[model samples]
Target: MTTTTQYPECCAKDNGDALGMNATATSPISVDGTPVAGELYTIPPRCGRAVKLKKGQVIKIINTPGSQVCDTWFFNSDDLSEFASMEHTRAFIDKIIPQPGDVLVTNQRRAIVTLLTDTSPGVHDTMIAACDLFRYSNMGITEYHDSCADNMRMALNAIGLRAREVPQPLNLWMNTPVNPDYTISWLPTVSAPGDYVEIRAERDCVAVMSACPQDIVPINGCSPKEIQFTVAG
Candidate 1:
């Protein structure tokens, strides 16, 4: 039998205390020229934020700088535990890489969001986990460096969630291609400046985004930078 649990309301229309942070006022704007419709938030490198998106509303993540990657995590506003599951989504969609019109499903197989649009030609990965301190330490850079896993934890905490509650995220603008020879390549992204992917909420959800801080690799255009967001009708 399928089971469902009750959770507190997590999203509201008001942006004043959306993520318990003054992101709208204090963050930098990453988009150039006149911006698009809806509220805009600038998520700086190594930083993260939680956004409240209502059902039917649209949220776009723009790669303001070329080849920069953003780690995106989604949670059902009502139940923080019910989040976007890449494994389940892939199993349901029967595809590793999602395209426009594909619906991202939750652990319960319920639709959470749909891919409304994509402007980037590069591929996005669903197999990788967000970078963490342990992962970095194994790579030999041990002093101390920011990571998407920590950033996501802080972002979710702003919304009253614990770090242990967060699950694997959808890594946007990431390029991890598999070869016929049964190998994979963690190559630099092909996405250019202003490229973006827009997704429509199938239900009320909270989104946590982190502009990757992996300077050890070329994931963020040889260095980390800021990213842009637009929530429109």
Candidate 2:
């Protein structure tokens, strides 16, 4: 398993703010990085982890196991009606071809988070499900370490949010390959320890994430690892 350390500092801002400061918190919450055995965290094949944040507080989820997927979603606490609609955001952000630097707009038409950094530079499907025992068995993957619902669930419980609806999640560090029939294959990740994708909060949005517990295939492999959520100054 890989350990995540040596977090780089973010001293710049892109929201047209003059400070251009990093979204470090005054009292940042640090949760123990624990790995669940057979849970995929939230969704059967997808889940959402949680973390409280300020409008400009920058949150970074470091992938310790490197290639493991950190599936996530962000919602508004004010009304909860306005949230990250994946299809809408995808269409609004990228009408034709989705690229970096596009803003993930919320249902209220607010800018949630700008696609700041994409380290993988490969395919990460928002359409894939989190791992689960049922799907694992159905897919003929029955070694018993397989799970897609591990981390995202834990995050929601830890942060005191009730499970409402499972929306489309952003798959972080997961590798997907497009075949001839337009089917995407989940391949191993292209990252190692210390390599991560960072996004600054465009608004004070609540984020849910799962450090994927998928063991069905070698994507996350058998040994699941830890990650870091640092709000630095």
Q: Number of the top candidate by lDDT?
A: 1
Best by TM-score: 1
After the best TM-score superposition of candidate 2, give how far the Cα of residue 100 lies from its true spot, in angstroms.
Answer: 3.9
- lDDT (C-alpha, whole model) for all candidates: 0.74, 0.54
What is the C-alpha lDDT profile of model 1 across 138-204, one tens digit per residue? 7775455577766776665555554344477888988878889979877788898999999998998
Whole-model alpha-carbon lDDT for candidate 1: 0.74
Query: Which runs of model 2 end up more than 4 angstroms from their true locations?
Result: 1-49, 95-99, 132-134, 140-150
Show model 1 residue runs off by greater than 4 Å: 1-37
Tell me the alpha-carbon RMSD of every candidate: 9.1, 13.7
lDDT of 2 by residue, 1-233 (tens): 33322223222432111111111111113352232322222222223346655676666666655666776677775654566766777678654223467677776678887666665554456556655444555666434432334344444445454334445577777777678999867677777766665666777667766566665566666445555555421
